[model samples]
Target: MKLEDLRGRLMAVDKKFKEMYEGLERNKIKSIIYDKMGKPVSLKKLSGYEIENITEKRGIVGVDGSINSYGGIYPHYISLIQSMAKSTLPKEEDIILQDVYVPLFEDEDGQAEDELKRRARMSKLELQAASFAMESFSSKVIFMDGSLMHYGIDCPSEWKKFKEKAISTGKIIIGITEEVKTKDIAEILKTELNLNDSILYDREVLFGILNEGEMLEFRRDLKSKKSESGIKSCYVRLSEDPQVAGLDFIEEQYVEALKYADLIYTLTPEKGRGIPLWLDIVDKEVKVTDEMVKSLVESTISREIREMLLNPKRSKRG
Candidate 1:
């Protein structure tokens, strides 16, 4: 295509975007949400006195994980997966748990099942690390870096045990999602209004609909043929930025979600995106970088074995 044709296409795309942007009414969407769900939950700033009261018994902890593959394809791949749980208490130490997945060692069906296996393995490791954190630390609040419902889907057995531990120990566990991805609200709206407009996701709908420190009360149900999970989830604007974040809580402790939300909002930076600083620290500690993968594979595996079993032909070409 010539330059003029490309310029014409770009102009058409810009015009279509403006049309869509003009059609959005955030307040109206917010009203529709309240009709389907309940009223919004108001989140107030935590005063020094309030913080002291909440943390008097125990400090908060954050749990996060990393998953990566070092080799080329199929049975030749070696995945490094680990999860870390860190506490805010000065005396407490980080708990790190690791897992290694080699398709050669397992009875995996095919290449198509690789990602699902990786996710399930990562969830298992994360839940185990969380269990350790709850048992070992003096923390009343435990924050997981991603969706709570995800683990339930990936590793249901381990996920149940983790939730049981949380309930038995009287700990508040909340999942913090940097990116929200769910379409229940869209489905509701489409059915109620009887129209198909091709635009209704919780993330896009809640963009600027919520005020800073305010949470849109919601119930996100995870339904599958094998199992069903009913976790309470909400979109909270922790900072002044228009971008919203997702907070998921187990059904057992969702009644006290407000109390936990205050602590989370307090720890998040007022000027930045809405994620707790503790979770960021845990993520940094648990991340499996390329260099770390390289070092682990090179140090542990014999060169002859690596070349015969795990090494890719692309490495030699490069």
Candidate 2:
């Protein structure tokens, strides 16, 4: 069958399964945690949790740390328990987040593409982390923070291997990118709006642990005048439909990497507010506390920025 035809059929199947699962009385969704090396780790089993560890490799970096230099290596962990349509007890199959860390390196010859390839390699480590988490508790789905493919760069073989391994195990792999025009937004504001590129340079700018209220603010900015244009791609490896048994969703594209994937899922929302809201699904039921989001946001941002600044170009002093 043609690719489009296959996808449509899969979507139909997925929708059916989702409807079926929605009606079942399931209890508690389990979330898996993975480190930068893809090894699974124990996380506090709280819905809205903020975990911080001071590793010998990465310091006790908060979401507010720098993104481009040396510091502690950190990754974001998010697990949300979605309420099925039918309310029996409470289903325990939850989604796990693999916020992989990419190390910073100097690229003088415009080898930013290489950085993306490196990021793909870094993701392999995250997959290992997922595997370890799965060994302990069964999770319904794994939600990755980025794409299966390397963005703006050719994909490496490891990316394909990691993605396919996740699919064969009957676990859904859902990838989400909230802002499609992230690079463009950074550039546009850098030029048109005269926003500082230093904003991107700040290693602490990207990470955040936002509550429902703060999430709402970010979502508002995402859809309003602060809205940026680009493709926030979503990809799934299970069935194209959300109802299917093995539905994996990837929001971004890969030239050859996706070819190895059995089912690819995508949904282009008119508004780019799904991520923070989706995160709120479990946050509301748990009555998430302020400290949860605060610590997470601060640590994630700080760690990411410091990583980006790993190998900066030195300025020549007179």
Q: Pick the candidate with the highest TM-score.
A: 1
What does each candidate score in C-alpha RMSD? 3.3, 22.2
**Distance (Å) between predicted and true CA of 232, model 1?**
1.2
Number of backbone clashes in candidate 2: 73
Each model's lDDT comes to 0.82, 0.30
RMSD (Cα, Å) of model 2: 22.2
Give me the runs in candidate 1 sitting further than 4 Å from their true place. Answer: 1-23, 192-199, 219-228
lDDT digits (tens) for residues 175-277 of candidate 1: 9998888776666655665536656666776788888888877533433221236577777899888888988888788887557888888889988778988
